[model samples]
Target: MRKLYVWDPLVRAFHWALVAGLILNMFVTNPGKTAHRWLGYGVLTLIALRLVWGLIGPKFARFRSFPPDPAAALDHAREIVTGRVHPHEGHSPLGALMVYNLLASCLIIGLTGWMLTTLTWFGVEWVEDLHKAFVTWVQLCAVLHIAAVIFESRRLRVNLPKSMVTGYKTLP
Candidate 1:
């Protein structure tokens, strides 16, 4: 199998770190103040780092490569539906959309969460509910992201989960 170093080191690191932080921050409910704050900070840092990485990274990792362009994204999606096996070198259409959605939603989640900690917004019941709702949406997006990965891996006959772990994908 041909091999390619598609994802940069920082991108892969940020991806896994965010995954861990989000997962831990999701299930651990003993929000004894410090733990909750630390988790939010961790997520914020991960997102910030990812933003930097995307700006100055390799071809596939660059924001220019994956910015949400509706026509192209939709055409690629249509190609996939029409059974055209394109030699896709970077993020696929649906994957790109998912990435954008996750990024925007997570930013909102982090902002609202951090806002809740501010003295000005402290004890605001609506902010609390908003944070909780965004967290739930984050979890749902994560699950859907995984399912998409699994489906794409199977369709492409590539072990994408392992590729993310190893930062390498065997090419066509």
Candidate 2:
């Protein structure tokens, strides 16, 4: 086995921060409270920072490291079907799609949530419903993300979640 530094500090921080913020908003913070709004804003800020980091951050942190390629994702799926192991130092192709999905979902949720606070959108049923719908979408994506991480970690013989926490992946 070899150890490789994968996730950078900022990337790790963003991952855990997003996890915490989502948990807080989903359970602890009431949507009607000022604290909830601030927390949501904080999450939006984190997402913005992450987007910038994906452009200029370290090698593995950059989006260039894992461009969204449908063919590559299909190949990864084939590898899984054939019981072949090909571990990526950064994100696997399917994982990249999930990252993009979560980012877009969060942005929509944040924007809709902010719209709810505006005079024009305040108490607008559809806008509020859109916000709630995205929240649910995020929640579903989070579950799928976790499941995929676990599956990949086992299939690749790497502690994927640990890599996020410690910025290192022990690969065989």
Candidate 3:
């Protein structure tokens, strides 16, 4: 067993903060419109920060390390199907997909949420519906992501939950 500092401080901070904001935004955005608006703004800010961090962050956080490689990702997917999961220093193929999806979906979700609060869109049914719809999509994706994390963590004997908190993963 070897120790690997995969997730850095900034990355960990961004991860937890974003999760909190997303959950809080979901609740606040519905009942308390004003709190919802602020939460949405916070989400937008977090997304922007993550974009920059992905570019300039540490080894595992950088985009260059996990840029979508369809072929390799597919191979990893195949391996997973065959019950040979591997914990490659950073996010595995499907995990990478979830990462990308989370960022993109959150961006769209946050943007739509913000749009609904604008002057011209006030009390607009369609905009609100679209925003709500995106939230549902995000919610579903989040659930799947968590399940995948738990599965992978168990299979690999990795402390993924703790790693995210401590910015360290003891590689197997």
Candidate 4:
């Protein structure tokens, strides 16, 4: 096994912080409460920082390293079906798509959540509905992301979760 530095410190910190904020907002903090609102703002800030980091960060942290490519994702799906293990230094194609999905979902959730606090959008049924819908979507995507990470880690012999925590990948 060869160990390679993959995720940067900012990337790792963002990942865990986002996880905590999402969990606290979704399951712990009551909606529209101060804690929930602050957590939502924290998530939004993390996303904004990640966006800027994607532009100026290291190789594996850059958007260019894992651009959302549907075609490549499809091919990756085919590879999975065929049981071919092609380990990626960064995110796999399907993982890239999931990353984009989660990012957009979190952004929408944050925006709608913030909108709910404003005088204009407060008590607006549609905005509230959209916010709730995105929260559900993010929850589902988070599950899928976790399952895929575990599956890929087993199939590819890479400790993906550990890599995210340690900023290194032990790849075979």
Q: Estimate TM-scores for all models.
A: 0.92, 0.98, 0.92, 0.98
Model 3 error, position 72 (Å): 2.3
For model 3, where is the 10-residue window of minimal lDDT? 25-34
**Cα deviation in Å at residue 48, candidate 4?**
0.3
Candidate with maximal lDDT: 4
lDDT of candidate 3 over 6-114, digit per residue (tens) = 8888888888999998887776456437787787788789889989988888879988888878887899878778988577888787788888888998898777777
Which stretches in model 4 have alpha-carbon errors above 4 Å?
A: none
After superposing candidate 1, which stretches have Cα over 4 Å from the reference? none
How much lDDT does candidate 2 score?
Answer: 0.93
The global C-alpha lDDT for each of the candidates, from Candidate 1 onward, is 0.80, 0.93, 0.83, 0.94
Give candidate 4's TM-score: 0.98
Among all windows of ten consecutive residues in candidate 2, which has the lowest summed lDDT? 109-118
List clashing residue pairs in candidate 3: none
Error of 4 at 12 (Å): 0.4
Better of 3 and 4 by lDDT: 4
Once superposed on the true structure, which residue ranges of model 3 sit more than 4 Å away at CA?
28-32
Of models 2 and 3, which has the larger TM-score? Answer: 2
